[model samples]
Target: MEINQWLNSAWFWVGIVLFIVIIRDIFIQKSHTITHNFPVVGHIRYWLEQIGPELRQYIVANNREELPFNRQERSWIYASSKNENNLQGFGTDQDFNSPGYIFIKNAMMGYNPPVNHPSKKNPGVLPATKVIGLFHNRKRPFRPYSVINISGMSYGSLSAKAVESLNKGAQLAGCYHNTGEGSLSPYHQFGADVILNIGTAYFGVRELDGTFSMDKLKQKVDENPQLRAIELKLSQGAKPGKGGMLPASKINQEIADIRHIPMGKDAISPAFHAQFSNIPEMVDFIESMATETGLPVGVKSAIGKLEQWEELAAYMAKTGKGPDFITIDGGEGGTGAAPHAFADHVSMPFTFAFAKVYQIFQRHDLTDKIFFIASGKLGFPEKALLAFAMGADSINIAREAMMSIGCIQAQKCHTNHCPTGIATSNKWLQAGIDVTLKSERYYRYHYTLVKEIAEITHACGYEHPCQMTMDDIELSMGDNNRTMTLSKAYGYHKTAIAYEYFNELIDCPHLGGANARNRLSR
Candidate 1:
């Protein structure tokens, strides 16, 4: 009787339930191949696979060992935004002896003496604000309210909440937010300065016939007193010499209405502009747009083929008709969606491209007339300082800004399933983002970055960032344990034979060098 009672207990029922579940998982579940082979044990593999990314980030991956962005980089951005303890306990995790290492040369005597300075005890100091587009010929050339501003991230590519947060942040930061090619939405009118970017698709300024509409452009500029400039997007770094596609699934009625395209259809941007094909036509288009907008009109491009740029510069010099500013996007720049090939192996990197473009414009004596905005992985102050030293009038921050607004770098931006509520249009995901809170983070991040730039400039003995020259930075060639100043690296030295070391051979006309070899081969 005792044996019978024990067998009929609750434990007997639980055992039976477990056995049934195991049997079903091992035999009945055909969807999972591993589960069929390993029975209940196979479920462990599925759970581990589900948590693999998180596991790597939290445990397996070290702070300095990650791609695109390391833990240290992300932590700095986050800590600076929150005003938290960002200082590391020990020294830097950087490999100082590594090849291709770059660093700024601090001066023994800074611009202002430490003895008389109020913040002598402190490590950071504020530098004078640098003005951009001052010499440009425009009815209202942008003075650049801030040297660091938000880069182009489209409305449709980002959620509405994200756009509003960014716009508000721009307002708080006293900077400008670029209205990307996705067209202008009401959320963009958050009392912030705006830059209207017109792409091949001509989103906001397109007519029913799919050509650029001057009337619409004029209306937008006239209505928005805060619309500071207009940027004509010839190409971006992510996909140079290629167009973009917005899948129908991502496009809603509001997006369709804004873009002036039908809903539930793949919105295609052509590879090249329809308004102009040749160089002369393109120049004419920019001049016409500047005249219509009365705001500084600029062209944004990713560097490719130095000869093509030379031709453009030469023509602009000849006609004196060109953009008031030029934004150079490096190949490493990020995009919401792009083809793998184009993103990986298309355009020149930022530092090299920036140096080449600056040399070309300087050679043509057009540098004084046009402003240069550099972008591509320039999230850190060191990188921005490098750009300023390389002749960039200003720098644009894109991916880092996204991180400030709560992007987890999931790399799922192409899909609408972004978990962070940033690169997604899904309502459920977007709900996770609190605009008010995130906007504060954006403000803090921008403030910290601008402050850091000033601090670095002061440390380098410069009164302002604009005063930073290539001479202030040094690059490790990693060949023969050699070091070269940025001026020497970019061939800005006084010596005539300095051109031999430059990568842009077209600019170097000296005989018996690589230029001569090219001529002989041709």
Candidate 2:
């Protein structure tokens, strides 16, 4: 009677049927070679592969072993965004003996009587903000409320809801959001300051022929009251000297209309700007744009050869004018889509490039005229302090901000399958994002980061980041016994230019014979 009851059980019957079906399909299916060979057993391998990332994240890898951003770094960002307790017991998981490690030279005690104003109600302190474009050339200068700001993630690269949330967060946090190369969308109209970035393709200000249009640009600036400044993008760190890539899946009607491109097609900017091929032409282009908009204009580029930078500085010094600022991006920058070769192999990393560029500007006495904005993977207070020590007046952040808005760092940005709804254009994916809630998270993250910077500055015996110099930073030599400060390691100072090299290159009558002159003129 017991045997008959067991045989008649619903669960027993269902399990038997399921097993029979799986065995039959595994053998019958010809598509997958492994399944055809191994039958039911092969599915286990496929299932494990499907859940590999989560398994590695939760069960296999340690806190600091991941790339792009480690588990511990992401945890801090998430906690800060939620305004949750981010404190951890004991010391850090970082390996102090690791090569190229960076650490600050902390003071014995806090800055005298607290550099920031004393607060009775709220004990937390705030970092003092700085002003950009403060030189005599500009009619208006932009004083951002914080030195850390949202970097150039475009509207098409992000969803409408994401862009709206970031803009709202920028407004709430008293910072600014950069409108990336895709140009302006209506979603960017939230009450916040904006840095309108014009890439090689000249999206928002481009004419029907794909050339820059002064009328369109003037109209755009006129319409958007939140416009604070303009950035002319020469190259970015992820793919220096290459244009941006927008996959066809994200190119909706709204994005196509704003970018003035055809719908249902991949939008790729030109590798180089067509408007200017020479230094004089580039300078003229920037001056004209600044004159037209009456807004401070700047150029953004990733470092290539050091000599090219010296040449650029020499040109600006000789010409007596150039862009109001120059944004230097590190090679580790994030991108929506790029060739793996360019993203990994091209451009100088931020630390080396920032130090070199800062020295060049100082050598030519152009530091006062052109502000330096450092970007690329500087999301936390320690990294931000390192940037200030390296001579960056302000900094930009992208991936960390995305993390605050629910991005899981799945690294599916190039694919349209961003599970968190931050990078995809699919309405179904975008539905997961709640703009109001995410905006608050964004504000809180920025607020917390800024407060931490203030606290670190006080601990470093400086009233502000500007007061802290290369003397305050120490780079580990990896031997665990030796370290060096920024001032000594840089070893760069003003010196007379090599007149012979310049005279032969620039003012030579033959310019190394007529053939060379003709080749250069063309």
Candidate 3:
């Protein structure tokens, strides 16, 4: 009687129907070779493959084995953001003998600040040693409160909540936030100072014919009081010599409105700017923008061929009409999406690229006239210090900042299905992010990073990071346990002007650096 009832049950019938449907679909699916060949068993294989990354992240991969960012790196960022103890118990697991390993040469006596100094009380209070645009004398020249700032990330590239959290956190952390080439959105107005990045598309300041519109640019500058400077992006590290693309799936009404583009179509930026064809014309364009807005103008690019850079530096030295700052993006930099070849092989890495550019400007005696900002994988203390020693006045962080605000390195940024709600436009995915909570995390992460960098600066016997020279670092040569000083390795030599501002800060007690210290004391 029990067997007869089980055979007639609806549950059994439903299972039978499901099995038949799955088997039929597997055999008939020509799109997937495995599914067609192996039928039902192949379904299991596909499911496991779909979750392979997660399996490796949580179980299979060792702490140092992961690419882009290792498990150890992610843990440090997570702990810092959560305000938890970030100290490691055992000695470093790093293979000290490996090539490319960096070692900081500590001083016999670390820098000791005055007993009454504010930095002595809160190490995170360290400020930039020099004022941006002071040499150029922009009408609105100001010192960036923190040497570390958020990097360019467009509104369309990030979810609304992510943008809101980053801007709000920038305000809390006393760092500037860059509004990337996708254009400014309401989410970026959360009390943070803004650096508007103008890409080849000129999304925010473009005419109907896709040409530069000076009137529109002026309007944007006038409308935003917190707007500090303008960055003209020639190319980013991720895909140098290529344009950016925003897929149609990520485009919403708000994005369309902000970018001034039509809906239901991919937004493509031109590979080259329509405003200027050559370096001289580019310089003139930068000057015009600065004059129009009374703000500092800068250029950002990834290193490629050397002739253009040499020409730019020579022209700037001869004419004195170049950008107030220059940002060098490393080839290792991240992006929402890019072609594999360009991302892997197009431009030079940050360390090499920056050295070359710095040397060029140094030869021309133009290093001091412009601020040098570096962006790559420089969020950590040692890396940031290396950048500073390499002549970087300030450093910008993007992927690390994203991790602070809940990115899991899922690498699904281009798919519009980001598990962490950071790089997605879907409402359901976005709901996972809590603006208030993530903003605080970002603040903590920024504060802790700056504080740690200050600690490293003191350890190297320097009161300010700008005082660090290439002589303070050594890199392993990966042979016979050999090591070489950065100065010897890269032939890097800092010009007299490189230390001019730091010397002035030391001599003048009423300067901006001292004033910042006084403000912190109060």
| lDDT of candidate 3 over 1-522, digit per residue (tens) | 998999899998988986885777666566877766676678889899999999999999999989889999999999999999999986889988888899999899999877966677766665566666777777876566678999999998999999999999987776789999988899999877789999999997887557888999999989987888899999999988899889888788898888878789888898989899999999999989999998889999999888999999999888878888899999995854788998889999999999999999899988877889999999998999999888898999999999999999999998888999999888899999999999999999998998898888888898788888888999998867799988999997665333444334334533332133343543
Give candidate 3 regions above 4 Å deviation. 2-4, 8-27, 496-522
Candidate 1 clashing pairs, residues 3+ apart or interchain:
none
Error of 3 at 85 (Å): 0.7
Q: Which candidate ranks first by lDDT, i.e. highest?
A: 3
RMSD each, Å: 10.4, 10.9, 2.9
User: What order do candidates take by lDDT, descending?
Assistant: 3, 1, 2
- The digit string of per-residue lDDT tens for model 2 on 10-46 reads 9899889768857776666778888767756688889
lDDT by residue for model 1 (162-258), tens: 9999999877766678888887788788977788889999987887557889999899889887788888998999998888898898888888878
lDDT of 2 at 297: 85
The worst-scoring run of ten residues by lDDT in candidate 1 lies at 494-503
Error of 3 at 287 (Å): 0.7
* Candidate 1, superposed: residue stretches over 4 Å from native: 1-50, 113-136, 479-481, 493-522
Please state the error at residue 304 of candidate 2 in Å: 1.5
lDDT on C-alpha atoms for all candidate structures:
0.78, 0.77, 0.85
User: Which consecutive 10 residues in model 3 have the weakest lDDT in total?
Assistant: 509-518
* Comparison by lDDT, 1 against 3, better one: 3
Deviation (Å) of 97 in candidate 2: 1.5
TM, every model: 0.84, 0.86, 0.94
